[model samples]
Target: MKTIGRIKTNILSMGCFAVLLSFSSGCGKDDAEDTVENCFGGNWAERYAAELEVYANAVSVYNETPTPANCASYKTAAKNYLDALRSIVDCVPTISRAEINASINEAKAEVDREGCD
Candidate 1:
């Protein structure tokens, strides 16, 4: 009977420890900031900057080539740029949507000026 009581106590202790461990480990809260910042996860501004770089590179290529294929690449990159802005607006509602849209408009103007579209 004493051995059985000891086993029950051990089981209860293990269960409590498991619960404590989960709470301390932030279970179910992993990457929670992903939603708060942007849909792609991790530093939103960095991702935005990287996408902008890609668009800039595509724009540069379009400027040199101006072929349909090059223009298509530019358009695709422009779409990605717009998508990132939208995602930022969606994920971080506290941010100014107008500012995000302004950036998008500026990028679109750049694309148009480059004749990429």
Candidate 2:
């Protein structure tokens, strides 16, 4: 049981780490300009940044407490972050789009495995 608990914790940690890594891998200036012109009326970057903050806060809360409610909140924040990232995929280069999609899908799987539902 202890080992299983550790494994779950590690999985969650990895998921959070992946989310953080994806957040860091943002678009370059040219891509950002394209994103601004194409997505959310030039506000996608700001929106994504805001969502990243919210997600970070949620992760901190979940880490501190590990409660079910906090877990649910974390999942919600993760989903929102994924959505924000997804919105600008097309505006980014193809390589970036593939990487972002992979991160999003991996994070989604992690959240699903969290079993908060």
Candidate 3:
């Protein structure tokens, strides 16, 4: 009977420890769920910057080509990449859309001036 009592006490202690462990280890609610906009999960500016970097990379590839073979794929791919980037940037509302717009306009001008393959 005493051994049985000890077993019951051990079981209760284990249950309590499990509950405490879960609570202490952050098992209940996520920080994102607690917040409204989840700016931590990358805000509009962050997303825009990420997409813009891709655009810049595509442009770099398009610009560095000295031959038709190098120029062919990069130029075509740059257009598609730039289009997708612009769409993503446009979807996200910005505090200063003009800044992004100016940069895009500059890129457009460069593209037009180059007239590459």
Q: Model 1: per-residue lDDT, tens digit, 1-117?
A: 223233223323333333343244322334556563334453445445666678668767866777878887866776676665555554333344565556556555544554423
- lDDT by residue (60-101, candidate 2, tens digit) is 787778778988887788778777776666655556567767
What are the per-model numbers of colliding residue pairs?
0, 0, 0
List ranges where model 2 is wrong by over 4 Å. Answer: 1-44
TM-score of 3: 0.39
To one decimal, what is the Cα RMSD in angstroms of model 1 from the true structure? 23.5
Question: Which regions of candidate 1 deviate over 4 angstroms?
Answer: 1-33, 37-42, 91-95, 102-117
The per-prediction CA RMSD against the true structure, in angstroms, equals 23.5, 6.0, 24.6
Better of 1 and 3 by lDDT: 1
Q: Candidates' lDDT values, in order?
A: 0.52, 0.62, 0.40
Against the true structure, what is each candidate's TM-score? Answer: 0.50, 0.61, 0.39
Candidate 3: residue 79 lDDT (0-100): 46
Pairs clashing within candidate 3: none
Candidate with maximal lDDT = 2
- Candidate 3: give its CA RMSD in angstroms: 24.6
